[model samples]
Target: MSDAPTTTESNPYLRDPDVQLMLRAKAGDDAAFSELVANYQSRLVSILSNLVYSQETAEDLAQDVFMRIYRSKNGYQPTAKFSTWMFRIANNLASNARRSAGRRKEVQMAGGDSSGVQTGNAGEYLVKEKSALMPARQLDKSEMQGIVLSAMEGLNERQKMAVLLHKFEDMSYADIAETMELTVPAVKSLLTRARENLRTQLESYFK
Candidate 1:
């Protein structure tokens, strides 16, 4: 869906060992498929946990991602890195889950959850505390993390995802663009805005 120029050089992923493993799995190698699953299981869960804000739901979604990949293995190609393809699926799955959750109009918010993400209800409380947080230097590590999480909660879903992918995953603009189905310029703009929002939300902490 990106309007940006697509890469014309041979995809670097074609030489990736993981892509080769996936190709083997595509050829009906069950063990190869299992290896791929094992390799990505933890990573998928980690990313999805941040996206959905629930460890349990993240695990379920990760399983769903693998299932979809397995079912579509027949059509698999090495046009991109295995990780890129995997995260693209994760990003889409997370977006769909958010939309579905939004339709219900009621979401439970739990504090001190294993996942650092905050749900809609959680964010409701955060808006009330926007006056100011204690200075960042005085807070402990846990408190700082909470502040960051609270700041992240203020971002809209797309901005949050863009921040997570760019900051946590260390993905390039092009990589993030591919994963989120946005143009490179859009991805850049999203991250810029997200960072500004984060700074504004955490202004007290930064000082």
Candidate 2:
């Protein structure tokens, strides 16, 4: 009997449709590549915008991510889900950008738009349990969104990234650990600390 594992056993992530698409792209299927880009472009931009706090910079970084993916297509492997692999690339790029730019100033969430990043359910995700503590005066959507954005901005970089992945992407701790190149326990710790920080910030609003 052969000692080598079967293909599916060796790379279970190959079962993912996106991973199939990526494999097709690696085989020089341009349409498959375009589909991957179309599917993930906005999502990448949204995540990067939250990380860098600039729509323009996020869009630019997203393009760079795709370009790197294209350049490395021949070397692509299906050991992880496509999104996990892509976000791992994004995490590294965002870290590099942050380091190159030094300290970043906080930007307020603009009116009429949440700065091109959807705050979808983030408020609920962060503070649903504390809803009863809120003041009797109901907060409008924009006001609550601003509060959430400020709380997100208050998190340190890794914590912010971990929270975004957990809430926005619905990634589990193991997936988050793979994306961020951290151990699962470390990812859990980051999220635990992030939730506490967010709770503290939200409590101030409730007060």
Candidate 3:
């Protein structure tokens, strides 16, 4: 079947066929590749922006991530949805970024994170509940963004990945497992622990 997705359609977002686009990318479709980039670049930027904190650094890191994706296109496999696989790569890159910073502090001096911004009487976890309702429900975009990033910074890398892909992206357990290379049960366990920890971090906000 040629293993390539034909990009006859101008806006794949209307089609929303990521798997098709990825297959096309695997088959060396530059237009398909550009479509993939256009669809995910902003999302990648938002995620990395929160993790890295510096806008400039996030941009560079995002570019590197896409470069990695480009490099990996030849070997791309559709084990999970394109989004899940992409986020797995993203989570890995973000963690490496933290490590590469060489700023190891005993969880006591996690700077620039600021433990997230409090919008109101809601605790950190509670604020998340509200943010989850709608992108433009009752909060400003920047405020919601800060909360998401700060909350993520506090989570363990694995937990953060699980939460980000699931809570933010609404991925399924099966998909998350495949993307993270964990068993389905393992992803569930990770989510459970992640929720608990976030709730704890958020408890202070409510208090």
Tens-digit lDDT track for model 1 on 1-207?
112222435456657788888879989998998999998888778667666666667888889899998998888867777878888999888888777665443433333223322334434333332324435464575456667777887888888878877777788999888888899999989999999999998888768
How well is each residue in 1-207 modelled by candidate 2, as lDDT tens digits?
Answer: 113232876767767899889889989998999999999998999888777766667888999999999888887877778999999999998898876554221233232322323222334433542354445464575567657877888889999999988888999999999999999999989999999999988997777
In the predicted model 1, the residue pairs found to clash are: none
Q: List the residue pairs that clash in candidate 2.
A: none
**Candidate number with greatest TM-score:** 2
C-alpha TM-score for every candidate:
0.77, 0.78, 0.64
The backbone clash count of each candidate, in order, is: 0, 0, 2
- Ordered from best to worst TM-score, the candidate numbers read 2, 1, 3
Candidate 2 overall lDDT versus native: 0.79
Lowest summed lDDT across 10 adjacent residues in model 3 is found at: 113-122
Task: Please identify which of the two predictions, 1 or 2, would achieve the higher lDDT against the true structure.
Answer: 2
Query: Is 1 or 3 the stronger prediction by lDDT?
Result: 1
